[model samples]
Target: MRPLIGVTTYREPARWSVWDQGAALVPESYVEAVERAGATAVLLPPQADAGRLVGVLDGLLLAGGADLDPARYGADPHPRTGAPQGARDTWEFDLLAAALGAGVPVLGVCRGMQLLNVALGGDLVQHLPDGSHQDPPARFVKTEVRTVGGSRIAAILGEDTQVNCYHHQAVARLGDGLRATARSADGVVEAVETDGPGFVVGVQWHPETDLSDLRLFEALVSAGKKG
Candidate 1:
């Protein structure tokens, strides 16, 4: 059976010609990436019940979105972090927690990666500016990252590969059951994953935007199949 992959969506207010309603939405690229990987993409509505998440899909992918509320990590909001979306934060956070508890495979890209870390008690830098910033700028430019052998991330990209990143906040401290598997110049956590099997990998980059070398999605799809 094609792996049933649950892709999370961002919640936003919508308007019709003469009416308005709240809606959950995701980008077409995300859905396309999943389908291209030979998996059936299921757009999981926001604020979904956590207990019900595991049964609907073999794996989950937390797609990118707005910055997380710094409060979730016990920090004063940074000036560059933008406004908080409390409802969205609560929804994704709860879903991530339940997904991990259920042992559902996961891949968190950019903001998604941060969410995974926060859910597991990790913290994030409220905002990142270069020079004095700890990690490399999320908008990495043709840079290579190093990965440890036998590491989950290493197994996906073969050796280290150049990736496209475009986020400011990044993993400051890792979450429980996850380890930093890859890093770049200036010491940014590039990738992370669970210690064991079932493929739970998160990258501080956007692999879907890098379709030229799509090993990332293929690996997720293959793992989802196994799950």
Candidate 2:
């Protein structure tokens, strides 16, 4: 059976056609990446009980979205920090905790990466020193990141690789049991992973944005199959 990968979605006000409403949605690229990686994609909306689904899922993919509440890591929000998506923050925190506890293969993208770090007891920089990561807004900028040897990221992306970046926040202090696996030229944390058995990786870049390379998604699918 193809592994079932549960992907998180954003809860936001959306407009389409003649109607406007709050929707639970995620970029189609994420779903496509997972499907192309040979797994079943399941979209998970924010909910109080999202964590319980980990028992049935082979893997968890936390898609990028709004900024997390800084209070999650015990800090006040910066002036430039986007308003907190409290519900999403609470739901993802629970879901991630459950996934970790269940030893499920997990991958976090962009804001998802930040969420993972905060959930694991780390804080964020709130804003980057430079605006290149998201200069024009709503667009991805290519940045080269150096990967640590022997890390899961290096295994998939080699020693140095160009990544699509679109975030203004980054990991400050690392979470417990996690190590920085990739960094940018400016020394920003680009990727992190747990040393435990099950696959648990997070990348600040949006791998799904560039389908030309699906190694990250493929790795998650392969791990899901074994899981």
Candidate 3:
């Protein structure tokens, strides 16, 4: 059976066609990327019992979304920081903790990466000036990231690679048991990984937006299969 990968999603007020209501949604790119990586993609919306699902899932994906509540890391919000989705923040945090506890493979993107850092007793930069990590609103900026020697990111994406970036906040201080594996030209932490047995990796880029390379997802699925 294909490994089941549970992806966290955004619960927000959405508008489509003539209908406008609160919904739990994630970009199709994330689902497609997971499916293309040879795994079964499952959307995990915010819930009181999200942690219970971790045991049955082969892997957990913390999909990119809104900025985390600064309170999570014991810091005041930056002036330029986006509004926080408190419920989603709490839900994803629980899911991440549960997945790690279960020793399941986990892949975190953009905001997901930041949350992982915060969850692991780290902090964030909060707000980056224009042209630092991101270009403009709704635009993806391309940048090259150099991977650490013998790191999981280096294994999948190689020592040097170009990636799609779209975030202002970044990992300021790495979490416990996590090591920085990749960095951009501006010195922002681009990727992090744990030395533990489980496959726990986080990247500041949006791999789902670039389907040309599915190695990252494939690696996650492969790790899930092993779990």
Candidate 4:
């Protein structure tokens, strides 16, 4: 049987046809990527009982979304910071704790990576100095990042790779037990991972949007099998 993977989602006003109302949704590309990687993908909306749901999942994917509340890391919001999604923040934190405790395979993308950092006692830069990560609004741009030798990212993507990026915030202070695995030319952290038996990796890029490469998703699914 294919491993079951749950991808986090956004809860906000959305429109389709004549209906405009609150919806729990994620990008179709995320689902497509998980499917292509040979896992069963499920959307995880913010819920109080999300931690309990992790019991049935072989893997948990923290999908990219809105900015996290700066309060999470004991910092005031930057002028460029967007409003926080309180429900999603609380839910994902609980869900992440449960997943990590259960030794489930986990992957984080873009905003997801930021959340992972903040959850583990780290912080974010709020906004990049040059803002080159996102060239245009609502579109991904190509950015080159080099992975540290012997890191999991390097093992999968080799020493360097071009990734699709659309994030303004980057990892500022690394979280507890996590180590930087990849970085860009500007010295911004691009990827992070923990030293443990579980598969926990986070990347500051939208790998799902870049269908040309499925190594990250594939790696998560492969780890899910062992999980």
Instruction: Output the worst ten-in-a-row residue range by lDDT, candidate 3.
Output: 128-137
Candidate 4 lDDT score relative to the true structure: 0.91
Poorest 10 consecutive residues of model 1 by lDDT? 131-140
lDDT per model vs. reference:
0.81, 0.91, 0.92, 0.91
Model 3 misplacement above 4 A: none
Which segments of model 1 are wrong by more than 4 Å? 13-22, 130-142
For candidate 2, write residues 126-155 as lDDT tens digits. Answer: 998667687656777889999999988899
Tens digit of per-residue lDDT, candidate 1, span 132-190: 32244444455577887889789778667777777777899899888999987768888
* Tens digits of lDDT, candidate 3, 83-157: 888889999999999998889899999998888999999999988877776777688989899999998899899
Candidate 4 lDDT over 21-95, as tens digits, reads 999999999999999999999899998776679999999999998999999999999998999899999999999
Listed per model in order, the count of residue pairs whose N, CA or C atoms clash below 3 Å is: 0, 0, 0, 0
lDDT of 3 at 100: 89
Which scores better on lDDT, 1 or 2?
A: 2
Q: What is the C-alpha RMSD of each candidate to the true structure, in Å?
A: 3.2, 1.0, 0.9, 0.9
- Candidates in order, TM-scores: namely 0.88, 0.97, 0.98, 0.98
Clashing pairs in 1: none
* 81: Cα error in model 4, Å: 0.0
